[model samples]
Target: MLKEFQSLRLVETDFGNDVKTNPEVVANIYSSLLAKFDHNSDGVISLEEYMTETKKMMKDIANDIGFMPIQMVLEKDSLLMKAVELHHSASAAHTIDC
Candidate 1:
């Protein structure tokens, strides 16, 4: 991955700046990101594989970049709350039907 990063010329670019500026750090981050989306037990990531693993990939990336805590607080909580509410409503409807 470090080789890829160096070959891809991520030096001083927007991606390099936003993420780790150091080439080694960027390489590590890139490797981890690729592993996150590498489904089908393969080392490569295809579009279909990536789409299938979207949620897990995003969560893994967030966790890797130390954004998981903020994400859970800001997004996961709301999504889980909505899911719980929907489940409760569905349960109530089922009870009424019965």
Candidate 2:
């Protein structure tokens, strides 16, 4: 995936691929991308790290949102939905116990 990501020919510039045609800037960009994606610094992106970063980004977006209700669509069987169900069930049980 990293190889594929690095192979993109997306950079278009007035000077034409800058710093000497298809140049060092691409490598620099990929290095920065790797640093961001490879959170564990193991030089690779694992599923866990990706998900952790994703959840942090979602929380950031949620925090940026104010007052307005944000609608999120999730499959009923998704783990997040299941977590919501479990919390509701536990709250109901706690009310009964009280």
Candidate 3:
């Protein structure tokens, strides 16, 4: 999760200040994302909701950091795909060991 966030250049700039490095700030960002993505006011976000919310948040962050929002969106997509790939590989390895 931290790696994904770090890949976002704008996030590193705007929120990258010392204050943003605090654990509390990181937790707040995750909590807010979860809350916003849970559209039905439900405690959980479906996969679709999570994707939609993530894109929106990325765009907002990009704009806030004075970068091209589209670039951020693309970067997010790349990061997500990488995460999925890693997860699948890890799961496959675990299954093989078992």
Candidate 4:
């Protein structure tokens, strides 16, 4: 995953300044990802482990980057709040019926 992310041409470029890319950042990120996925710390993450971690990380990124503005809007909008409440009620009813 770190290799894949590094392969991405998403270099931070400022006009004429050479930004020093920290290899340690990639290492740290990979280490953290591996630790999160490798429950037993066996130096290998299985497919299931990878998928589980990927899903969790994606959800976290989504909540952090995508949901912040929506959450703020929800906080300000009574209509949205009512709609969310209605949806929650419907879901709860469905679950109870099930």
Clash tally, candidates in order: 0, 0, 0, 0
lDDT by residue (tens digit), candidate 2, 39-66: 8799878998888776666555544443
Point out the higher-scoring one by TM-score: 3 or 4. 4
Off by over 4 Å in 2: 7-22, 67-98
What are the runs in model 1 whose C-alpha is more than 4 Å off?
1-20, 56-98
Q: Give lDDT tens digits, candidate 1, residues 1-98.
A: 33654666544557555455675676777777667767655777788876667645454554454423453344556544444455568768999999
Candidate 3 residue spans exceeding 4 A from truth: 1-33, 67-98
* Best-performing candidate as measured by lDDT: 2
Q: Best by TM-score, which number?
A: 2
Which model, 1 or 4, shows the larger TM-score?
4
> Candidate 4 clashing pairs?
none
| Weakest lDDT window of 10 consecutive positions for candidate 4 | 58-67
lDDT by residue for model 3 over 13-68, one digit each (tens)?
45645534666666667666556767887676778888887776654554444433
lDDT score of model 3? 0.59
All-Cα superposition RMSD per candidate:
9.1, 7.5, 14.9, 9.0
lDDT tens readout by residue for model 4, 27-75: 7766676578887778778798887776666545544543355544465
